[model samples]
Target: MRCYVVGGAVRDRLLGLPVSDHDWVVVGATVDDMLSRGFRAVGKDFPVFLHPRTHEEYALARTERKTGHGYKGFAFHASPDVTLEEDLARRDLTINAIAEDEHGSLVDPYGGQRDIAARVFRHVSPAFAEDPVRILRLARFAARFSDFVVAPETMALMRQMVDAGEVDHLVAERVWQEISRGLMSERPSRMIEVLRECGALARLLPEVDALFGVPQPAKYHPEVDTGAHLGLVLDAAARRGESLPVRFAALVHDLGKGETPEHILPHHYGHEGRGVALAEAVCERLRVPAECREVGVMTTREHGIVHQAMELRPATMAKLFARCDVLRRPERFEQMLAACACDFYGRPGYDMRDYPQIERLRVGMRAYVGVDAGAIARVLEDKSKIPQAVAEARAAAVADALRAA
Candidate 1:
């Protein structure tokens, strides 16, 4: 049996990128052959094994045919007769289809090296259109390699797939999985743009897709619309090295703007309140994790108020903190502020602008936490009145802190 290193490791190395993992394609190897060499079978759907020593995955060279719909509807064939070329032919992208043998001899059956040099994302064959997940993966790859562009033919093929209702079959877990990874990339906006380019964004995330042409009341930069602003926010979140929750919050913080009435034009007076429910709907639809959903919802519900923190009354600010559960969960509050900062900096010519609101919120957080709620509660005999007294004390403490400043 001959083993060839294939997929991401080889592709990343060819592009002078740091290789994180090695995926081996074992040609002319059977399940028993791998087991005899101490490889543990790990893949549930196909013949994939883990090396006993390095623990890296070693999948047998195989070709698959689309049996039905979605990504999971496929039949696999793996045997000693499967050729390396056959396996590479079934891969999604030409760049990932390259293989390197044990002697380090490169095999370029699909012109992966040429495409890599051209900084292009090209599909390998007609089979590329079979899997719906490939579209998400391609978009994610665009986010990672910010300079690379998708080939026109490949883009057209993806559009065809979308038109054929292939992407509509994608499940929520898989959609979230790919999108969350793309959100963490260096240029997360590219993922959104790529998905939009081929119309997958409209099919998958109609809420976000509806935002593109909508106008916002605030135009910090020349960015045309709320959709352009969303792209900027996503990239800004990535630039700040934010966690997933913060990034997600930055993504959906403006959903309510999409639901604005045409007569109102740019002004979305109560978008934040409307956005809270819309954001929650998106979280529920995507089945996002609780942490991400909570942060997304909070940022959507309060980002407008957060931007106006310095102007808010101390009582109002205290109510904001208390409503956000700042005393109990301060980290979530911090993430909310960070997401708001992303929204603040996302516009053109706004990166240099000072966000004094964040500092004010931080000061308020410190003062809000400094209030001895336990002490105030113990002194108050009426338990029902304790909440009101504590809230008043907290607001007063914040007022004093702001006054001293």
Candidate 2:
């Protein structure tokens, strides 16, 4: 049996990025032979083994051929005769197909090194169309490699995949996996743009696609359109380097603008509640993890809470703070502010001078909702004392503030 490091480990090593996980491909090896060598066979449909010592994956050399529809209907052939080049050639992208021997000998059968050097993302073969999931993967890669551009031919092939309805073949879990990665990226806006160009965004997130060209009152929003405004927020969110959930909230924070009534002066009246529902639906559709979905939905629902809290009494402020205590994670709150700022700033022709009130509100929030140790301890104490006279008083004060806002 012969084994070589493959996939991201090799690609990342070449790129000088920190590599945490390593996957190996075992050529000239069979499942029985691996078992005899003390490797535990794990994969049900394919021959995958876990090394007894390192516990890293060692998948047997296999080739895939499309049997019918989509990515699932594939026939796989595993044999000792399959060469490393053949295995790499069947991978989705050139940058991911490079393999390295144990001694660090480079294998570049598909010009992956050249593509990586040129900062280009290109599919390994025309067979890229056989799997619809590749489109999402390609978009995710674009998000990860912000400096890289997809080759024109690869873009055309993606368009062909989109036209063939292959994009719909991806499961919600797979889509969410790619989406989460993109949201965590340094340039998630690139994913949105690439997905839009490839027509995958419209199918996966039609609500977001509907934001395109939706009119906002010119007085408040001088930006090109709602889609453009959202893109700005995405860019800002990416810059913040927030966690995945918070970034997702930022990405979808203004999605409800599409549903704003034409007669509304600002074009986003009551959008917080609408956005919450939209975010919830989108997260559910994508089957996001429960905690992430909850945070995204709650953040969307309470996006306007900060604005509402500005006029509250001290007692009301305490209750508002308590209610949103979990959200006071500084990074997440800052991310939310960044999104809100981007939304406000992105409005076309709107003067920066016009929004001094938002800045003031942010300062007030920082004072009242800070995430100091004392504040967290107070929240924990308050949780056990719920329904007390003081809690009731605080809730009433907060209610009054909500009415005033």
Candidate 3:
């Protein structure tokens, strides 16, 4: 059996990127042949094995045919007769379809090297439409290869897939998986833009898609369009080198703006509280991780408070902190502040702008957290009274800190 290094390993290597993992496509190999050689059979839908020594995945060269709907509806055929070219033909992107033999001989049946050099994302064949997951994958690739342009034909095919209702069949887990990866990529805004272009954004995340035409106060948001502001926020998150939770929060922080009453025009007076439920719905719909979802919810609910920390009364700020459980989940609170900072600086002509409110919140939280609630409870015989005393003490501490600031 001839083994060829395939998929991401070869593609990344060609792009001068770090190859994280290597996958081998074993040509002229069957399940029985692999088992006889001590390769552990692990694939449920197709013939895939673990190498006896290296332990890397070794999937038999295979071709797939669409038999139904969704990404999992395809039937994969793998046998000793399956050719390397056949396997490559079934891949989603031409750039990922390239292979390298054991001797390091390049196999470019689908012009992957050419496309890579051209900085283009091109589909391999008509079979690309078989899997709905490809749409997400293409968008993710756009995020990773920030400079690469999607081929017009490939984008058209993606749009066709979306129109055919393939994107609607995407599972929540898959949708979250792709979105989270895209959020962490080099240029996450590109992923959202691509999905929006292909109509998958509306199907998977209507809450976010509805934000496109929504208006925002031009004075506060020089970008003017809430959707464009969201894009800017996502990119700002990337620029700040934020974690996934912070990035996710930045993405969902303005969901309530889309639900603003038309009569209110661009004010969005109560959008912070309005966004809390909408952000929760988005998190629930996408099955976002609990940690990320919590941060997103907190940011949506308290971003305005965070932005106005310096101006808020100590009691009000203390209530905000208590409501957010800041002392218990300080990291989440920090993430909330970071997301708000992204939102502040995401507008046109506002990059790297100073946000003194964050520092004030940090200092205030530091001082307030030092107040011992247990000690205060010992002084108050009534257990219910202890909460009020603790809150008052914390508020006093925050007031003093703010005054010192």
Best by TM-score: 1
Model 3 off-target regions past 4 Å? none
User: Candidate 2 versus the native: TM-score?
Assistant: 0.81
* Candidate 3 C-alpha lDDT tens digits along 210-307: 99988888989888999999999999999989999999999999999989999997889999988889899998888899999999999998898788
- Tens digits of per-residue lDDT for model 2, 1-405: 789999999899889999999999999988889999899989887899899999999999889989977678798899999988889888999999988887889888998999999999999999898998888888888888889999999999999888888888788988998888988887887888899998889999998987887876666556648787777666666764557766777777777777887788356789887787888889888988865765566567666665454554556555545655533355545555545554454444543545443454444445443334444446665565544644555445444444454
Q: How much is 368 displaced in model 3, in angstroms?
A: 1.4
TM-score of each: 0.98, 0.81, 0.97
| 2 or 3, greater by TM-score | 3
- Ordered by TM-score, highest first, the candidates read 1, 3, 2
Which has the better TM-score: candidate 1, or candidate 2?
1
lDDT of 2 at 83: 88
Clashing pairs in 2: 221-348, 222-347, 222-348, 222-349, 223-347, 223-348
Taken over the whole model, the C-alpha lDDT of each candidate is: 0.93, 0.76, 0.91
* Candidate 1: tens digits of C-alpha lDDT, residues 314-362: 9999999988999789999999999999999999988898999999999
Instruction: RMSD for all candidates, in order, please.
Output: 1.1, 5.9, 1.2
Clashes of each: 0, 6, 0
